[model samples]
Target: MTSININKEKFGQLIHKEKPVLVDFWAPWCGYCRRIGTAYEKISEEYSDILIAGKVNIDEEPQ
Candidate 1:
């Protein structure tokens, strides 16, 4: 499964979901973040049935 793009609006609901959740906090300008993103997506597909993979872009939705 593809990683879900999450923001403040969806965060609360996602965290409370029954399935296990993997939240990746990232920024567009960070090279390391981008590099790991691809690996994260691949893992998400492999374990999609058991986990909910979500990504939060700090650059756009800072808290």
Candidate 2:
């Protein structure tokens, strides 16, 4: 299975439909967030069975 993007509006749908979700809360301007995103993406691909990662931009949405 592949990972999908889940946002605030889709939170309920995702929670009900997918198992073992990994949410990445981040801002575009944050360097650390970018680094972590890269790492997460790599891991997401490597272990597709155990994780489903999605990125969230905190600046544009309500948290």
Candidate 3:
């Protein structure tokens, strides 16, 4: 399964779900974040049956 794009409005809801969630709060311009992104997604798919993986782009929703 693919990781979900978590916007600010739905962040709280996603975290509160019964199935545990893993959230990656990252910025597109950050090299380290970008470097690990592909690995993270692969992990998401691998564990999707037991958990939910989501990502938040801090640059898009800076508040």
Candidate 4:
């Protein structure tokens, strides 16, 4: 399963889910964040059956 694109508007709803949620808070321009992109994708799919994997782009969703 693909990771959900999370934003502030949807964050509240995602957190209230019965299932566990894993959120990756990142920024596009961060070098370290880019390094883990593939690994995160793999993990998202691996655990998708039990929990929801979400990615929040800090640049776009910074509060």
The count of residue-pair clashes in candidate 4 stands at 0
Model 2 Cα shift for residue 25 (angstroms): 0.1
C-alpha lDDT of residue 6 in model 1: 93
Q: How well does each candidate superpose onto the true structure, as a TM-score?
A: 0.92, 0.77, 0.88, 0.93
List model 2 lDDT by residue over 1-63, tens digit each.
444566788766666655576788788899998787767888778877766667677887656
- Please state the error at residue 6 of candidate 1 in Å: 0.3
Q: Which structure among the candidates has the greatest lDDT?
A: 1
Tell how far residue 37 is off in model 4, in angstroms. Answer: 0.8
Off by over 4 Å in 3: none
> Worst ten-residue run, lDDT, model 4?
2-11
Worst 10 residues of 2 by lDDT: 1-10
Model 2 residue 21 lDDT score: 69
The CA lDDT at 40 in model 2 is: 80
The true-versus-predicted C-alpha distance at residue 20 of model 3, in Å, is: 0.7
Candidate 1 wrongly placed segments (more than 4 Å): none
TM-score attained by model 1: 0.92
Number of residue pairs clashing in candidate 2, backbone atoms closer than 3 angstroms, sequence gap of 3 or more or interchain: 0
Clashing residue pairs in candidate 2, if any? none
lDDT of 1 by residue, 1-63 (tens): 799999998988988888888989999899999999889999889999999999999988898
Query: Which whole-number lDDT from 0 to 100 does residue 18 have in model 4?
Result: 92
- Cα RMSD for predicted model 4: 0.7
Question: Model 1, 26: alpha-carbon shift in Å?
Answer: 0.7
**Candidate 3 lDDT tens digits, 1-63:** 989998988888887888898989999789999999999999999999989999989888775
